[model samples]
Target: MKEYKFLRILDKFEKIYTKIGVDYDKMRLILSMKLTLDSRRTSTIMQDQNKNNNEEDKNIFNRALIIYAIMGIFIGITAMVSFNNMYKFSILFGMFMFLVLTIFISDFSNVLLDIRDKNIIGTKGIDNKTINAAKITHICYYIFLTSLALSWLAIIGSFRQSPLVGIIFILELIVIDVFMIVLTALLYLLVLRVFDGEKVKDIINFAQIALVIIMTISYQFLGRMFDIVDLNIIYKSKIWNLFFPPMWFAAPIYAIEGGHINQIIIALIVLAIIVPIIAIILYIKNTSKFENSLSKLNIAKDNEKEKKRGLFYKIGRNLCFNNEEKAVYDLSTSIIKKEREFKLMTYPSLGFVVIFPLLFILIFSVDSFSEIKNISLHMSLNIYWFIFMVPTILMALQYSKDYKAAWIYQSTFVNDKRNIYKGAYKAVISNLLLPLYLLESIMFIVIFGMKVIPILIIGFIFMLIFIVIQHIISKNKLPFTLKMGEIDKGQNIISTLLGMVILGVAVGVNYFILINTYLLIIYGVILTIITFIMWKKCILDFSTN
Candidate 1:
């Protein structure tokens, strides 16, 4: 009986061991796999960290050392070359270079910070506990502070000889630095929130236009402040006193006055009041409507998509060898397949027209209205031409990309090449050109008033002509391509140069016509005829193959 019980216990123990048996080899393999994955992840993180460190070091060196060195050399060279005017040339050159460098560094650093934040936030499977927004913010704030320090250092190095002037300069630098930082932050946020997707490009362009306007208007103000002009008008009306106030504008004046605390206090008070008021107004306006503005933008995006779909359908049918229904179906499929390409074609075109005006406002301000008017009138005619022409180049790039992705398969189904050309032409005109032209018309009317109607009509006609020319130049190729991120520098240069030549002619015509109604009509008629002829020739050539 004892032997049997012992055997039974042994049997049960064997069964339990079998159920929980470990395959040593398999366990080892699993361990190895986990180790490999962990190692790879660690390696990737280390590599990314190294890359980021390197980039940060490079930017620091470039901004802090390289830029200063370049400015110093440039100033020295200019001073030497100018001989007798060495002091004057050096001062002016130093001022200009420092200003430009400050702007560039500020812009570049902001972009880099954005890219870094995006990368960090986008990292996969990172523990929420490990992420620190405050850390990132601190780092960015320090980087900006460092850049400002470098900028100031450069300024001091440039003008160290004059102690009194240096003191005034340092004070001015402090004021400007604080102002620019606040302004840049506000503007950056405003742009990102206000402009969606590719519309940011339009804002940038508008900022450029604004700069041109501001420069023209500010020239008189600057001249008066510097005492370069003895215009009694500047001293008489106290307009200069109110508008071009001494606090910031009279840096030279302050240097000459030699540390008058009372005057500085008065200026500071005026600035304090003005700055807070502006900031409050901007904050209130932006905060109040930001949400609604974003919603409207989203709606606009949906509308744009619908318009694109409608255009593709219409054009696709025109390009088809078969029945309209079949063509429409084919086109829709093609578009769906190449949605990214379509976006690429559309976004840039929209950006060109929409962003320029906003950018103009930012850079030039309202004070430069006269210069703005002159430049706008001169460039207005070519704006449409550029609007139409640029898409062709962008389309060519897109088409090349699409072709690589096998989008060319759609072409094989078409009975004639002309059908394909016709569809693409129609697609571009309806989807891109018409919307942009409408926007341009609205902008011109707003900026130039009722007098711009004739110019708008003339511009539209020229725009049509340019589109045909672009199609012909591109040899009836679909603007959709599959190549990603490949830029043809040669083609870009050629296209840009050609567009400029056309612009020159438009400007010349505007100059001759001035505000004469009959002259405007005559010019418009002539331009329309020329454009129509060009369109016919180009379209015929494009349709042939």
Candidate 2:
């Protein structure tokens, strides 16, 4: 295997590392193996892993950095945009920090929380410092690569303004990265320290879910935080803005450029520096504790308590038609309920389905409380928007990291194979979409009134028929049988757009139908029949692969 350039650079610091009581050589070896193994796995955010195992595709991580560099061009533009300093940098750093934090949470969490290293290597007489150093370096290497890709343009832009400005940006950038990493580690460490057994493990898992939810909601507020008119930006700070970290990081630049300082700016500067320093010290002290906390991941859960999942089985029994369908329904719902990675991947889209359109309505669709009652037609059309999630969610359902376990599906006897997807489709709808559509329906009914209920039922039934046709007709992969490495983000975007287009046609057809209540009732009946026929056949009767 080719040596990593970063490893060669580290060789020069070997004496320093060794003197600091780390086994530098062993640490390097461990990190090298990690990189090599990771090279075979595709990144979730940046690129598709070439399933062909092409030689050229081995540099997937390098190509991912290139994508980040391309994204950095926007940061450069934001830094140099013609606007007030605080407003622009708050926006810039908001984008910067969001990228760093989200990427760290999704991609690096697996690396950080993985217990195989501790289990396998800790038994071989590797010192604590060496193992910990190796783990920390694995994380830092990715963060450094990310920052290098994402900050180069911003650094250049700041340098053009003033060398000191550029230097300060670099220093604060490092500090912010350190603060985020340390703070996250500290949260997990404290939870593990305080709680015992399955509770801490379950709490840590939900913490990731909570972070995703909070991050997505905050993302919506970013656009709302500024007022833009005729290409000019205006931002007025409120006391509430103190809740956002981007504002704190951006204040120093504003103060520096304005040639004045205030108590608020001084406080922010102290926070920007002091908090990270404190966090680093505490994190360093808890290094052993951090290692122990990661070991909790290896704890085996009591499967006996899974009777609580009887609710999931009841959902399958209620939704499917036959035993074959019921078995697969139980299997699909179980995975959806238990898999952390599935929730992480799908929750953002799940949130977007609600947030994007509701925010649109709040900001653009209605001007006053009275105007909401007049939006019946708007609500009717927007009901179809939930179909936008079908392509993405169904695609997510097809791919899994544990695709090999799917062999169980093939090894089992099935008289009717089509019932397998039937069950799987019903499970996804019942478990994921049914609740989302119903929740959105309630909100829409509250806003547009009970008059929207018929439309929601028609729209939802139509979605079930439409999704089965799209999935079974387009690319029918057995549930959870495809490696996630085969996915391309571009493919997801295109599929989602196609879903919108298909549903848009129905919305147009329903527009004239809405002109007559009788025609709308007839339209819904036809859709119900189509859904029944689809349940009868899933594109020539498919089987789990």
lDDT of 2 by residue, 1-545 (tens): 65888899889989967875788989999988877776766666553757644453375778889989998998888776557666766777777777777678777776677777778998998876688778777887788789879989888887877787788788878777767777777878888887766566557666655665565556556556667789876665556666667777777887787634666667766777777778877876777667877766656566634743655455656867779988898788767766766766676567667655566666666655577766656545676767777777777787787989988876899886767777888888877788778888888888877777778889888888888767754465788887775775665666667776788888888887776878878899999998888767644554434
* Each model's backbone clash number: 30, 0
lDDT of 1 by residue, 296-401 (tens): 2222232344444575456644544445334434553445334543443344335545545444543444444455654545444444444535534434433433
Tell me the spans in candidate 1 whose CA falls farther than 4 Å from its real position: 1-157, 160-228, 231-452, 470-485, 510-533, 536-545
Model 2 Cα shift for residue 87 (angstroms): 1.3
lDDT of each: 0.44, 0.73
Query: Once model 2 is optimally superposed onto the true structure by TM-score, how far is the C-alpha of residue 355 displaced, in angstroms?
Result: 3.5
As for candidate 2, its clashing pairs are none
